[model samples]
Target: MKMTDPTTSAATPDEELSALVMQISSLSKLALDMTKVCIDVKDKLPHVIAAQAAKIAMAIPETGETVSTPWFEFLDAPTPEEMAARYPSTNGDGQNYHVVCAGRRPGLYADPDDATAQVTGVPNYVREKRKGRFEALRFYKAVYREGRAFTAIDVIVSDDDDE
Candidate 1:
């Protein structure tokens, strides 16, 4: 395949990096919001509300392709060739790669947006999964690139992955 122009591919790596960084940030924010909801109220947050927030909070990133859902089926979604044109693979660094996340809570529901939530053979990596409810109503991010891929750099969560 013909590689994208340098100016075009130049932003690909940065986009991937930005995606991963935002993922970590989002996970942290979700955990924080859930904890806040738990502490502020006497009861657990409603699943629908939590679910909705989760949808909004967890966003799948796009470089050229659009994320119909945040988690699962990134491949099934449509991509504008012009958007795909922006990403040219790095020699080995995976500069133009993509990202998806799925967390399995005991009450986990299949979100059209969740990638890991949909597949069984793949691990849900519940260590990082958020459990129970959100207070914030708006939990969505728009199409953009993360600072890095989820697996590319270090992520620091306050609690243990299983906690």
Candidate 2:
């Protein structure tokens, strides 16, 4: 059968078939590239998780404190009020504050447990302090070993221009 080219309005079945094949080949290559990108991300997933876990571990206190409740199972196991009291003000600026986890600023509160309304509202509280700007007190957990037991290291975030 005779075939006509749609774009050029010319009868060239061989050329049309060749063009279609090339287009298909290009699409296949693109799909392969995308698959590779996905695979790369998947391959790095474990490392990312491990890094996050390490950070959390570092945030705990070195005293080897443990909590009975699952809610307070964090490293330091500080209550919301305790955290607020511990860091009453950032750099003693006379502004009361709350603690939030690291990630985006103003960051999300690190309250895994349904502690209190103040803990839940930490993000909003910080945002209000910054006049609607997002900010957070990032905490990190680390582990150091002397012999057998690993000592927990509490890493507090300091004010930096990079943040």
RMSD (CA, Å), each prediction: 26.8, 15.8
Residues 16-70 of candidate 2 have per-residue lDDT tens digits of 9999999999999999999999999887676566645654553443476763222
TM-score, every prediction: 0.21, 0.33
Q: lDDT by residue for model 1 over 42-146, one digit each (tens)?
A: 443443355344443434343687644324311111122322343332344312111232232111222434534333332222212222222000010111111
**Candidate 1 minimal-lDDT segment of 10 residues:** 135-144
| lDDT, candidates in the order shown | 0.34, 0.39
Which pairs of residues have clashing backbones in candidate 2?
A: 57-141, 57-142, 58-140, 58-141, 58-142, 59-140, 59-141, 106-134, 106-135
Candidate 2, residue 107: the lDDT equals 25
The candidate that achieves the highest TM-score relative to the unseen native structure:
2
